[model samples]
Target: MSAVTEGRPRSPWAAPPRPAWEGEPSKAGLAGKGLVLGIACLAVLFPLWIVIVTSLSSKKTITEAGGLVLIPKGITFIAYQELLSGGQVTRATIISILVTLVGTLFSMTVSVLCAYGLSRTSSLGHRWFLMTLLATMFFGAGLIPTYLLVQTLGLTDTYLALILPSAVSVFNILVLRGFFMGISPELIDSARIDGAGDWRILWKIVLPLSRAVVAVITLFYAVGYWSAWFNASIYLSDQDMMPLQNVMIQLVQKQEAPMGMGQAIKTGQLSELAVQMAVMVLALLPVAFLSPFVQKHFKKGMLTGAVKG
Candidate 1:
């Protein structure tokens, strides 16, 4: 190389070479890291793959495979067909969907209103309300007391039992209240000057600017409601009213399927494992499809709501 070329000054915009301490990694290190990651991925995905395969396998294949199927052969969706054809499973799935949608909407509305009211320091009993919510976070009514309260209100064996008792989350309220408090007071003042009522200001001004946190909170509540089973098991005595998650628990933990699928099981057309796996897949699909749409907001929302501005 020419001396001038070698001696040329570095451009100001050029990125500096990595320091020797952070120099290129050894092939061994790269290989080891890749190996570790690959193993971890396989470890996590292997069981999921097995579940899918087992659910898709024929009764004979499952029987031959002994238990969980690692390799899929003679794939059949009869398991899914059996589960879906059974009216009970279908009804349970519908119930779960309804609960998730209605519960999330109700919870979000209450949380938002409570948070907004609590955010205003000038509101009456603001400190007391805040303390109460925080106390609930630290302490909860025992299961017996809570059940009695639900029973006293005549919510047992009803859909209201699944929703009303756990409608508001103290943690969610605190997070949202903190977020609302972070909004510039000038914005509220400007809205007030424009003759915007508190309702209008909250709806038009606050919510639009708080979409990220709202999406995160909505997902949180939706996921919680979707996965909830203990509440249903406690409050609902009617088999027809039990949600998918509760039914799933019955199937997986107790190896029980509703009467609709029991005939197929009795006839040796479906295995208990296949039915359980099918139920898992059915429950997973909705959340899996829904997550990607809201994932973009998740990280930003959590971080922004968590950190004071």
Candidate 2:
């Protein structure tokens, strides 16, 4: 028995030491990771820094300095003052705000209703209707046809040209439909048993629970409407009916004219660059302010709509 015990295999503690390379930290690897991360952060931050500096710089300084500013030496608000003062630009800004607000409300309401209706599996022709809606995303009616249709509807030179034609967005509808589908089936059944009709269920149950998705889609619609100019230029012939973007384009053109056209032209050429920057800043403020408010919900909303289905 003693001989058998001695012949048995020894424990792993009896093994030889491993090579030093096995456990040592790699300085090169750590340095590479740090370098990549630093570069990525700089790439993202540089554009934002430049925009802020340009927006705050004086017109004369910006013109003299061939490149972007790292630090603004002299800050001024003269550009902002010129933009807000009475002109076609101010009128257009008012028009744009109104359109954005009204269009967002209208688009969201219609999208919610359409999406909710289509989300139900038992709804008639649901698949076919959904496919038809999606088809419009890839292929649009030609511009001429769309223009003719608008003309036939007597919507030219009117706000309805902007509001009614774009009342529903196919992409937004799909996002909302996916969100509605993600709601628990059991909750819907319970609502039914409690004598809740479709409208009541949508209002009391669906909408309340869908705040994140609704807010995200509302932001999308608002930004789109605020930035829209092509439709306005095409359908609205009246200068008074122009939106801010169109007016800004006209202002830029005048600024680009030769130096000796007239007194007004000379003044425009002198102030054009500053005025352009100011208009851009004004147009961007609403989006900048509103984005952070909805940004918290944006990722969750997009994921709920996209990956869920």
Error of 1 at 36 (Å): 4.1
What would you estimate as the lDDT of candidate 2? 0.81
Native-to-model Cα distance after best TM-score fit, residue 290 in candidate 2, in Å: 1.3
lDDT of 2 by residue, 7-43 (tens): 9977787876668766565999779879999999999
Please tell me which predicted candidate would have the highest TM-score against the true structure. 1
Top-scoring candidate (lDDT): 1
- Candidate 1, which segments miss by more than 4 Å at Cα? 1-36
**What Cα-based lDDT does every candidate model obtain?**
0.88, 0.81
- Residue 308 of model 1, lDDT score: 53
Local accuracy of candidate 1 as per-residue lDDT tens digits, 38-101: 9999998898898899989888888999988889888888888877875788899999999999
